[model samples]
Target: MRSLRLAAATVACLSAVALLSACDPEGTDTGDSAASGAPSAVPSTPAAAKSPAAKSPAAKTSATPAATSPATPGKAGRLPAGVWVDPKAVPLNAALHWRAPGPAKVLGEQGKLQIETLCHTRRDEYHAEVAMVETASLGGASGDWKADETIASYGSGADSSGVIQTTYALMGVFAQGVKDCAATAPGAKVTVVAEDVDHLFADVTLPQADGSTVVVHEFLVSNRGSIAELTLRADLPAGARPKTAWTAPADRQALSDALGKPACTAFKDCV
Candidate 1:
C-alpha cells in the first residue's frame, strides 16, 4: 500500500510539470499555434466576411448622371391630325363671334364638299358664322385633298370682326401631287389657282366689352380671294350660372353610340 501511494504522487507531480511548461512566465506559446505561416490552432473565417467587394457597379454608381443624345428640330406649330374635336361644345363667347363671316356658298362643280356653322344670340342677333370648301382633282388618289380652302371672319360685341385665310394641299402624301400644285399656284390662270389655297390652323383673340378675353381657334383652308366664315358665340347673361350654359350642334348620335347611352345624356361630362 505504501508503494502504491508513492507511484500516485509521482504521476501527479509529472502532470503539474507539464502544465507549468505550457504556461511559462516568459510568454512562451506551447499549444501548437503558429507565429508566422505555421498552421494556426484557431479555425478559419467564413465566406460571408469576403462579400463586401462582390457588389455590382450599378448599385455603387446610382448617383451618376446618364449620357444624353442631341434632340432633332421640329416643324412649326400646326394642328395635330386625328384629334377629334366636338364643334358644338366649343364656347362661342363675344370674343370668338366677332371674326367670322356669313355662311358660305359653293361656286362651281369643282367644289366637291362644303360645311357651314352658325351661332346666334337668343334674340336672333348673329354671333358667329362660317363655311368650309374641299375639292380634289378627278384623277387624284383616294382620300387625297388636291385643294382645301377655308375663309373666316369673326367679331366681338354686336359689331366686331376679324379675318383669316388658310389652305392646305394633301399633295404631300404623294410627292408628284404636291410638286404639281406648288409649281402651278404661281402661274395658274384659273379663278381658283392652286396658290389661292393654304390650309392651316389659326388662333385669334378678341376682347369683350367688359375687358375680359376670349380666344378662338379656326380650322380652315384659305385662299387669296373671298372669305366666308363661322363664329362661336356664348349667350349666358352676366352673373348667370356657368353650369347652366349650353353648347350646340355636335354629332350627338355619334357620342351616344360610342358610350352606349341615350343621346339626351351622351355628353353629360362635356363642358
Candidate 2:
C-alpha cells in the first residue's frame, strides 16, 4: 500500500508539468503571456499597427486671375490750338487779330487755327503784315491747307557735302508765281533773298509808274508742323532799299523759339 501511494503522487506531479508545457509552448515562464489572456508571442501585421484615424491631404484649388484687354492709344484727350501760339510774343506795336471766324476748331484728337494776324499796318506811305497759323494732329489726317506739301518737299534729297539744301526750289516756284502776279498787276518782283532749315526770307520790289519803289520783306517759318508768315512792307520815296537783312536772322530765331513747344502738351491722348 505505501508503494502504491508514492507512485500515485509521482503521477500527479508529471500531469501538472505536462499541463504547464501546453500553456507555454517554449516551456519557459515569460510573464507576458501568463499575465494576459491574449497570446502576446504572435506579432501583429504592419497594416494593422497603423493609425486608422489618420487624415488624407486636402484637394487643391485653382487661384489664377482673369485675363484683360490691352489699352488703346490716344484715349486721353485732344490738345488745344491756342497753346501753339502766344500773342505776347508778337511785336509790341502790333495788334492781336483773329483770322478765324470763331474759336479754335477741334476734331477728334486734332486742332486747327485758320490765321492770326499780329500787325497789318496799311498806310499810303507804308504797309506791314505778320500772320501765323497752327495745326496739330494725332495720327489723323493733315490740315485742310496744303502747307504740308511744302514742308514735305523740303529735306527730300541728299547732298554730297551733307548740307541740307534749303527750300530754294520752292522759293523759285514762288518767284515764278510772283512774276505771274506782276505780269498782270505790273512792276512787281519777288525774290527769295535768304533761306534756312525753317525759314524763307523774301524781298518784294514794286516799281511804281511814279518813280517811287515799294519794298516788302516777307518771312515764312515752320515749327513742329505750325506755319507762320510775317511780312513788312514800306514805300520808299525813290530808289530806297530794304534794311531787313540785318534783323531777319534774329527775328526768325525769336519766332522759332516761341513756337518750339510741343502741341501735344495740351492733349492727354498725345501724351
Candidate 3:
C-alpha cells in the first residue's frame, strides 16, 4: 500500500509539470505576435507626414520669380508747343527776327514767347538747335490759322540772323539748310510733326494706315539747364497715319545720354 501511494504522488507531479510547459509556450507566442504587429500601426500615425518636411529643399526652387522687362522709351509725355518758358520766351540778349515772301501773313503777334533749347540730333551728321516759334499758319491747308512753329537751326546759328533756306517742304519752322543736308542724297526729305503737345499725359495715340489709331506712350528728357536740354513727343489723332515718307527713329536714348542719362542705341531698342 505504501509503494502504491508514492507512485501515485510522482504521477501527479509529472502531470502538473507538463501543463505548466504548455502554458509558457502559448504566452511567449502571443507576446511575439503583438510586437510584430506594432510596426504596421506606425505608418498610419500623423507623424508619417514629417517625411515631406525633410524633403523641403525641392519645394522652394519652384517658387522663384522671373526677370522683368525695362521701361519703354518716350515714356515721359508730349512736348509743349511754342517756348517752354513764357516769361523768358524770346531772348533779351539775342537780337532775332523772321521773314517769309509771297503773302505769308504772320498769324499771332509774337507774345509770351517760349523757347526750350534742343541741342542734339539722332544722327551725328549735323549739330542741331531748335526753338518753338509762337505763331500760326497763314497760307497752305488753312487760310489764316494759329499754330506752333518750330525754328530748327541747321545753318550756323553764328550766321547773321535772316531768311534761312531749307530743302524740307515744311510749313512750320524747319531747318534753313535741309537742302544742304540732302547733298549726300537728292530727293531725301525729313519731316517731323507734333502729333500732340501737352504738359503731361493722357493716352498717347499713334496713327495707323487703316484709318485706325493705336495708343502708345513715348519718353522725353529734360536737362539741368531747362533751356539747353529738351525732348519732343506727340499723340496724333486716331486713324491718322504718319506720311509714308515721314518716319523718324525716336532717338530718345542718344538724346537723353547727350543730355544727362546713360547711353543706348538710338531709336531701336530704346523704344
Decide which is better by TM-score, 2 or 3.
Answer: 2
Question: What C-alpha root-mean-square deviation, in Å, does candidate 2 show against the real structure?
Answer: 31.1
* Candidate 2 lowest-lDDT run of ten: 58-67
| lDDT (0 to 1) per candidate | 0.26, 0.36, 0.25
Candidate 1 local lDDT, residue 93: 25
Q: Output the TM-score of candidate 3.
A: 0.18
Best by lDDT: 2
Off by over 4 Å in 1: 1-197, 223-227, 233-271
Candidate whose TM-score is highest: 2
TM-score of each: 0.17, 0.31, 0.18
Which regions in candidate 3 have their CA more than 4 angstroms from the true location?
A: 1-203, 206-219, 227-238, 245-251, 257-271
Query: What TM-score should be assigned to candidate 1?
Result: 0.17
Superposed Cα deviation of residue 115, candidate 3 (Å) = 16
Scored against the true structure, residue 260 in model 3 reaches a CA lDDT of 24
Cα lDDT tens digits for candidate 1, 1-271: 9999999999999999987766536666745443244543457675544555313222212222210111112511111111112232323322222211223233321222222211111111121112222221111112211112222211111111111111111211111222232233332111111222333222333344564433323233222211222222222333432232334325533422221211112212111
